[model samples]
Target chain A: MIKLTYRDAVRRALADALRADENVIFFGEDVAEAGGVFKVTPGLYEEFGGERVMDTPISEEAFIGAALGAAITGMRPVAELMFADFVPVAMDQIANQIAKYRYMSGGQFIVPLTIRAAQGAGAGFGTQHSQCVESWLLNIPGIKIVVPGTVKDMYGLLRTAIDDNNPVIVLEHKVLYNYAEEIDEAELTHVPLGKAAVRRVGKDITVVATQLMMHRSLDAAERLAGEGIDCEVIDLRTMIPLDEETILESIAKTGRLVIVEEAPHAGGWGADIAALAADKGIYWLDAPVKRVNMGGALIAYSPPLEDEVVPNVSRIADAIRAVMRA
Target chain B: MTQNGIALPAQMRQDMLKKMLEIRAAEERIQGLFLENLVRGTTHLCIGQEACSVGVAAVLQPGDTMTCTYRGHGHALAMGMTMKALMAEMMGKASGACKGKGGSMHMTDASIGLLGANAIVGAQLPIAVGAALTSRLKKTGNITVTFFGEGAANIGAFHESLNLAAIWKLPVLFICENNLYGEYSVWSKTTPVRDIAVRASSYGIPGIVVDGQDAECVYHEVSAMAERARRGEGPALIELKTYRFRGHSRTDQAPYRPKGELEEWLKRDPILILKERMIADGQLDETEFEELRESIDRQVVEVVEWAKTEPYPPVEALYEDIYYEG
Candidate 1:
């Protein structure tokens, strides 16, 4: 077993993907020699050489579009959007082109590509660089979305995403980059998507989250255990092929639900989960589904302001306690 | 022929003329279908841009890939997408190019190397670059081509794609069929510069302008650059100075066109230019040209009749082709 950070896990997965298949190529702004703006893709350029590992100009639409173009031609391209906030700049390619290519083309083209982007707040990237824009992408069909919360998931899910026969977006939370754990080499297996991981098992209330929120929810579950809350935390691995069965089954056992997400409460992934419970698991729910979200305001530059909006351990625990009372 | 000093046989010229005629006939039939309210949604016809399509397709080898914009009927037909499939797609039949999922705007056939046609302006540029990158990475001596309009030059994707393709020395030909208008606005109003080809200089790649009305000229220009690109000499932007005889879509009457502009372009019509050239050289007589046009017209009529009998996709189709199962 070896200790690895979430960042290291992602980089390891990338190196492995490139090594395993000659068809896989990586490119984005400062991703090659500069090692990416966040230092997540260093040494890949030297190891893979310039031909395979490329550095592109700051053109999100082009590079992202290039990923689509390259994928359709039987090349597996891992394109980094640098920050998820910059998705709007290339929204045309992501939502309209890459996602719709297979459906609109009558399945004539199989876009075997992965687009990795650093997302979520807590690093003080301010409003422009630290936003989580999954809602913008989740709305688009013909695309798969994967959010790996821990080092294990970061290693496993990325490997799965790279080999998937569709355009998959692998969103790496900026806050979890330094999160580390001990993992065996064999444990770096391809984790199938659409399966939720039960982080903590309990029976009182079901706590659902993804990315950083999953970690925070687990922390909340640990703290709430002392107060006899007995929370079951579920980590949603892939957002698109949502593991409804897992979430619903947990809701059934617990008879209550609290969704904590690192996004706005309105029209966010949390809302979708809440709706899912309302639609199918309403009979099992002992209380109205609670949502612990960052609300609709933009993340501020100051630490306190940012913390106030982002869902944390305390917020998640409070929500679980509130749901327990219900 | 003039620039590359390549000799063109009378039969090859006649074949090119036949393809151009086929596109012209299909477009005319599509317009008729639109008038009859048989076509679904909107339709963009490349009536006057036939030469650009024929020229670029002629330059591309069998395995070479190409992508075009929404106004891509001419390019699709020239690149070997069947008239039946295209007509069926326009009429929303199950046997359409995209199984009626994509109407006129998203025509695609991967088997013939057409990645797909894009609806959003300038979306296909990066995709073409990516395909070129695939050629470079796989060491395939094939060139990729992308067709866009003059208005696409002002978009960010166009600039980014040119820059990336140039820096990577990927084998691609950026074909800008300057059809004089974007949708409703004239080209001069949207663009600051006169020549779209000059923008290619920013990336230090060769940019050339060809008479878009002359299929032979466009063929000569694209062929020269395509060969050099196959040799890994980087990318080139070829501006085919063409015009659209009809409105951007079936709905518009093209009242925005300047006085006598349509007349001037029609006088140098791509099909007529070839027909007259061939006639002057005694390659084909007036009766022979009419016979060729009549054959294509009859084929288009048969496609429309067959497509009308074809049923729409089943309800289950809505849930299918959204993702590729591995």
Candidate 2:
């Protein structure tokens, strides 16, 4: 058993992939000598040398596009955007090029590329730096999205994402970088994508969460257990090819659903999940699905103001209770 | 034939003329097919820009790769893409280059190293750089050529990709086909610089301007740049002064162009210029040139006929090829 922070687990997984495949290379702004801004890729540059680990010139569009180009031509590149909020600057490459190339090319090219970006707003990094924009990428087809909530998942999912023969976006929550957990090395393995993990199995209500919200939902579930409210929490690991089967099965078992996400409530993936439950599992539901998410406002730098915007443990618990009451 | 200091054997000159004729005939057929409602989606034609595609692509070896913008039929045909597959793709047939998924703008054939053509203006620039990066990392001595229009020079990716390619000394050739207009707007209206190649100086890389209507001129300039790239000298940008005879899309008639502009460019048509040069050099007689055109016209007609009868992709294929299972 080894205890590691989410940041270190990511670093370890990246290092492992680099060591395993010579075709793997890492590049981003300050990702080389300075490690990453969040320290998620520390020591990789020194270990792999400059040829494998590179620091780019703060050009997200070019570097991300370059990653896709490299992927199609016999290289596995792990490119990082310092924050997810900046994705719009390079959205054309992400949404139009990387997401469509595989299908557009008639499967002639496989984009074995992984794009790692920091997401979420608990750090009070302001609107430009703290926005959770995973929902913006949810509609883009031919790209896989992974949001790991635990240190183990961070390691496993990063490894799996690097191995994927298509473009995969890893949305690492900025707040979860420092969060640590004990991971059994023997049990550590490739966590398959498009599958959800049941964090806590219960019968009263089902709670679906992702990334930072998954931990908060689990914390809320633990607290609710004392109040005789058994909440079944399912951590949605991957977002694009969503684990609809797992979610629907959980809803079938619990008869009620609550979704917790950090992105804005409007047009968010939470809404997609709520719609799925409504459309396919409506007959199985005991109440209208509740969505706990950020309000439709720019994330502020002030801790108190930001707290008012983002979903927290209490917000998740209250939503759970509300859904149960309904 | 000798033109712009580029002297080639009679056979090679004849082949070049044949290639340009093939592109011209194919595009003409496509225009007719589109008018007849055979093609499902709109197409961006490359009628007047044949020299830029043939000239730049002629310099590439078998392993060398290239990517282009939506107006990429000339580029694709010059890179050795078959007329049958391209015509089928435009008609959205099952046996098309991209299995009917990419339509006209996204045709690709990786076997000959034609990295998929991009619909987004400057999206392929960074991807070409990435392919160059792969060559550098693998010590594969391969080079990548990326083609974009004058409008793409204004995109942030152009600057970013040039900067990265310069710093890393990646083996890439940036070919800018300055085809006068960006869709409906004149190039001058969008860019401050009169010459797009001059912008390459910002990245400390060599930039050259060539007469894009002369295939021999483009071939000579791109050949020199490709030699520099293969020898590990880094990236270079070549701006081909060219024109597009047709509207941006099938639906547009280009009312924005000034009076006499199209006529003035039509006088310097790339195929006509090449044919005249070949005839002047005594490499081909007028009758021989006419015979070559008739042969290509016949081949294009057969390919289009075969494509029209091809089947559409099955509905079940919608869920496949998004990811590589292997």
Worst 10 residues of 1 chain B by lDDT: B1-10
Cα distance off (Å), candidate 2, residue B74? 0.8
C-alpha lDDT of candidate 1 relative to the true structure: 0.90
lDDT of 1 by residue, B26-137 (tens): 9898888877889968888999889899988988888899999999898999999999899899988899999999999999999999998888888999999989988988
Q: What is the interface RMSD of candidate 1, in Å?
A: 0.8
lDDT of 2 by residue, A1-326 (tens): 78889898889899999999999999999999999888778789999999999999989999999999999999999999999988998898899889888887888988999999998888878888988777899888889899998888988999999998989999998899999888678656778989899999999999999888888899999999998999999999999779999999999999999999888878999999999998999999989888888767778888899988888888889988888788
- What does candidate 1's lDDT look like per residue over A1-326, in tens digits? 89999999989999999999999999989999999888999999999999889888888989999999889998999999999998899898888988889999888889899989999999988989888878778889889999999899999999999999998999999989999998788888899989989998999999998888888888889898899889998999899889999999999999999988788767898888988999999999999888888777889999999989898888888888988898
**Candidate DockQ scores, in order:** 0.87, 0.81
Flag regions of model 1 displaced more than 4 Å.
B1-7
Query: Scored by CA lDDT, what does every candidate get?
Result: 0.90, 0.90
Per-residue lDDT for B1-326 in model 2, tens only? 12367577777777788899999999999999987899866799999988889888788898899989888888899999999889999998999989988988997999999998998888899999999999999888899999999999988888999999999999999999898898889988888888988888999998988999998888887888899999999999999998889998998899999999999999999889888888888788889888989999999999999998999999988877877777
Worst 10-residue lDDT window, candidate 2 chain A: A181-190
